[model samples]
Target: MPIPIELSLHRHSRVLEIAYEDGTRFKLPCEYLRVYSPSADVQGHSPDERVLQVGKEQVGIDKIEPIGHYAVCLHFDDEHNTGIYSWEYLYRLGNEYEARWNAYLDELKQAGHVRKTLDA
Candidate 1:
């Protein structure tokens, strides 16, 4: 069964406090979440068509809209708002953030893109 995620927005800190039904809590920066959104813009039509997001150090969640019982829509200040993040998908993202983020950085390095870590 997929775990339920209760994500609370903390505008002051620019972080999303994501809590899982399994007792996991993640304080994810908005920029990190925004850059990795599972939308067609980022994921593309297939894995081989994925596009790397660059220069997202200043991105923030402009709004969070509810989507039925399946997901939440994230509107980014940078104008990215197509993804509907399901609880199951959000849980997976939080669980694999560190590893996946590192992989993203590696890919960026290979492509000569440098990532700027912003303090949230």
Candidate 2:
């Protein structure tokens, strides 16, 4: 069964609080969700063809518009509004976050991009 998500924004953490019809909960960081958007505009058709999105350290979702009942169209502060976030995609992203995030970090390091280490 397909799950429907009721998403709410956590302004302080810059996270999207997601609750599925099956009672699963996900607190998806805006940056993580942004980078993993499944839209063709972001994912493209091939893995190597993916574009690197940089300068999103301070990016946040400014608004989320409902697209029928299947997805939510997010508008980011950086003006990236092409990705339509469906619930299935969001769930998959959440599930794969750890591996994907690590890979992203490795890719950034390989590309000579620096992610500042936090004091925390």
Candidate 3:
């Protein structure tokens, strides 16, 4: 797995910037991270138990906390703070961003859920 040498959260843009030791850089969006969180609350313990996160279009990260040398815990403004995003998982998320994001949107559409708007 590529190790992250730097991580920055751009609040205005709502993106997490990560630079890996191998020179791979990714600007992951907060909504993507929140919807794809690796926490049990989101992922659950099994595929059947997984819950689809909805209405987080404008979610933002409040803080990031490193967990040992492996992962970082993201504290979101929506009170979700359990996901420990490892470098490998983060890398995968970045690499497969478009596909995952599109799939998520499709899932939401099929479920009759819409992203939260300011007026919502």
Per-residue alpha-carbon lDDT of candidate 3 for residues 1-120, written as tens digits (9 for 90 to 100):
999999999998889999999999999999999999999999999988879998788899999999999999999999999999999999999999999999998999999997675556
Off by over 4 Å in 3: 116-120
Write candidate 2's Cα lDDT for 28-100 as tens digits: 8887777777767778889877876655656689999988877889888778888988777888777787898
Per residue, candidate 1 scores C-alpha lDDT tens digits across 10-110 of 87777888877778887887877886788998998999988888887777787999898878999988889999888877877788889988887798899
Which one wins on TM-score?
3
Ranking by lDDT: 3, 1, 2
Query: What are the C-alpha RMSDs, in order, of all predicted structures?
Result: 2.1, 2.0, 1.6
Give model 2's TM-score versus the native structure: 0.88
Candidate 2: the clashing residue pairs are: none
TM per candidate comes to 0.88, 0.88, 0.94
- Candidate 1, lDDT over the whole model: 0.82
lDDT of each: 0.82, 0.78, 0.94
